[model samples]
Target: MPRAGRPASPLITRRAAADAALSLIDSGGLDGLSLQAVARVLGVSAPSLYHHFRDKEELLTQVARCFLEEIGHQQERWSDDWETRTIELSLATRRVALRHPNAAPLALRFFPRKLMLPAYERSLVDCPYPPQFHAVILEAVEKFTYGSALFAAAAEAHHTPAMPPVDEAHFPYLASAIAAAPASDEDLHVEALRALLDGFRVRYGPRQR
Candidate 1:
């Protein structure tokens, strides 16, 4: 378990400070995280935090990097089935975003693309498809995963709109589909992902047995 309070000593390192900031984000979203707020959580002078992070932007960037590292860790022992690997990797990304919805936007938007090279490079090495197909698969899956994850996070952070009554004469099928949709955002995302994966299988063919 993460420590509940400020560290006992004055020697609060950058990692510890980031952890504290993340905790604040977990509880209250991005609005809750600020250098001054983190310092208070750590029971240290606000100026003290500057020793570890040059500014709030730097600290936030670090937080984003941390989550990417976590996603990388989650992929370590994923299944060999290529489709399964895609699903698990997407879910792994979703799990982190859900966990830190407030901080997730920052990571999704500002986390350096170069930092992702190691993980995606490994995917190229392990993937059986041609490089072009591999790139297509990756891009498609990332679009689905990140777009769904962002929508999920945003839905959690805000109210879901109530559907207006549909005109049966004009849009019956659309209304019926909306009415039958899963209430949970996570469940909806799963169904969407499966559909996307199915499309990929049809278009690109199955991975090697």
Candidate 2:
């Protein structure tokens, strides 16, 4: 008979369990990640997970921390311009989220505070944008990136939006803009970022542009 508590296998470590949980998220998203599911993936019992993590919340916290730590280390080389560095940081963050779409929601939901690394925070402080706009820009970038990641993930899963056929006469301008918009994900992201950054330039200065 198996033990009443703790993992059955000696090889199962905290890192291993976390990795397995992340794999589950990547494959089935946050809804698919549970202690039982992780245990199933690792060929162990659900109770075994309690050995490394006190509960589901603690497990998620660890998972988010791991991803945040990885993101922290994935920074680009420092640039002379703080604004340039800030944009580069946004792109880097978007790239990371795109690479882990399912995991993005978990990070967004449970650990919003941990999303922005310290170094990036410092760069934003030095940025020419006023203090009021700092929070706005950061939140906007994060929301956009997280939404984009979900869109990309859905696309990969062959989920497409069910938009009714546009009637030009009924909504001419809206239809025209939609028809003219760039279809590629990266293009849309860049366009949105430019528009947002342009607003900052108009209000504060052109340093971000």
Residue-wise C-alpha lDDT for candidate 1, range 9-117, written one tens digit per residue: 5568878888888888878888767899998998889999988899988898878788787777875588877767777888888888877777778777667778988
TM-score of every candidate relative to the true structure: 0.79, 0.72
Predicted candidate 2 versus true structure: per-residue lDDT over 138-197, tens digit per residue: 777667765765566555444455245789999999899888887966667777777877
Whole-model lDDT for model 1 versus the true structure? 0.78
Residue 127, candidate 2: how far off, in angstroms? 0.9
Native-to-model Cα distance after best TM-score fit, residue 131 in candidate 2, in Å = 4.2
Q: What's the TM for model 2?
A: 0.72
Best by lDDT: 1
